[model samples]
Target: MRPGQRGARGRRAAVTERNPGREVSAAKALQKVRGQIRLHLLSHRTSVTASGTLHLKEGDVPYTATSRHQGTASVAIKHIPQELVKRKLLMINGDVHDVPVEVVLILKATGGPESAGSSAAMYLLDWYDLDQELILVLERPVPCVDLRQYLKEKGGSLQEHEAKIMMQQLVEAAIELHSKQVFHRDIKLENIIVETGPDVPRARVADFSCGCFARKGHYHLFSGTPKCAPPEWYMHARYKARPTTVWQLGVVLYGMLDGHPSFDTLRFLRNKLPINSELSQNCQELLQMCLSKVPKQRPTLEQLQHHPWLQ
Candidate 1:
């Protein structure tokens, strides 16, 4: 039971933009903030942000602080109930190293255009913006069993429909972002969120703080969770960062159905394993096609949508 999971149903709310104006592009609204909490944020084991989030450790309690984050000139202050207040916080660079998803890094990363579309890969939420007292809130991540956990729970077996549904959701989300020209450098089970609520478990892609906007060319990032990453991503981190997202998704889809990785066996010996054969050939082929090392050979999200398994 993660923070977002509600009941045994493993259901999650639809990952929708609840508040429309609630979105504040840290890039666009930079100078709008006011009242920076003047405090020396220090943490012994707590995590922090690069440009905004701060964590502090006091005696035995931990405090989480959101520095006027990105956007706005000067941020505002908001009131927090005594119960909601965490103590002993630490603040650092834009990294915000210690947070639920390390999302602060995306704020530091170059974001795509405001019209980046539904899958733009990231969004700026306006949670706390009053008198420096930040009201930090985050999106309700999708609540579905991660591949590894799913395998363990299912003993390495998943229905074809289940695997296809998950892959379709991820591919569609990627399509949305691609249409808007935003490149999500990282895509893995740890990052892919699924809404488990009775609402068809809409899968939402997340973690774009490390994404690319204008594509000055991949900068080789040690992004992507280890198991789901493409071989090229591991070898050439910076320059080949985002292009491999599709491949990662493929690997994730394969692992979901087969209970193991789809990459090279020797290289990924530590990662590779066997999987269940409870899926249709069409679906497996689709997964393998996406995992192709040749980026161009990977089916576009649009192409994937029309996949026979999906059809």
Candidate 2:
């Protein structure tokens, strides 16, 4: 919390921009992408929701959905419009011509309040609930794949430059999440999607079912992949928000560059296997700061973004 100079006011503004509390009309959202978008929901699959199982047709522009679904229909629909509008603006302003749209589907069981879950921005196209299954739709980046698969395809490790690009965007996205008072408890290779075909692929942090609103500095329970757990969690049985986030980012960076995580347990993180020697000294230093055994020693989100390696 004390690692960065970003003030409370600045943080508030950033949070306000993507706060998820903001509401967008579902009818209007449906109207915006009605003819252009199509959703194909798979049935009889064991998974509760068909979030990542989708075949979308958007006016001949096509992409699969890689989304995370949770309890609320509202939260599931909220992120869709923001993504579509974001990509549209980027194209209009000529900022990046080839940015991919992020699509998601929320498959929820038939009985839950619409507003009980995590925060979501207001954008609902259309959602249907039938036979105890709720199918929600959204968009995702095209010509891209999950980071886990990408790493495997690259023979376990990514080139330094590619890793840098992915981490930068990921760090930025993390900052945005923290600013919005959201803690993405699950930050791993599978949850991060890499936009392919660019000279340097961009990354987006996807999936929010495992996330929740950060209340104060303490979160009593842990709800994420065990591989990314911090040492403090194993020691004290509960983890704070910011430090846990820093530790997860470290795990992610290490996995990207080394082709695998250095440690999966507190005992192992305390004695993290030697970092890959191929990494530059600065990159290594950043990883050291992030993977620190002591929670307090870890960098804040703001500080991590400006770390020398990322710059």
| Predicted model with the maximum lDDT | 2
**Please, what are the lDDT tens digits per residue for candidate 2 over residues 141-256?**
44668789989988998888888888888787777666645566768887786767677776766655455545445555666666677888777777887888888888888889
Task: Give per-candidate clash totals.
Answer: 61, 8
Of candidate 2, the 10-residue stretch with the lowest lDDT total is 1-10
Per-model C-alpha RMSD: 14.2, 17.5
lDDT, candidate 1, 130-178, per-residue tens: 2323243333432444445545666774677777777777777676555
Q: Kindly provide the TM-score of model 2 when superposed on the true structure, using C-alpha atoms.
A: 0.60
Model 1 is weakest, by summed lDDT over 10 consecutive residues, at: 34-43
TM-score of 1: 0.53
lDDT of 1 at 232: 57
Name the candidate that leads on TM-score. 2
Provide the lDDT at 24 for model 2.
35
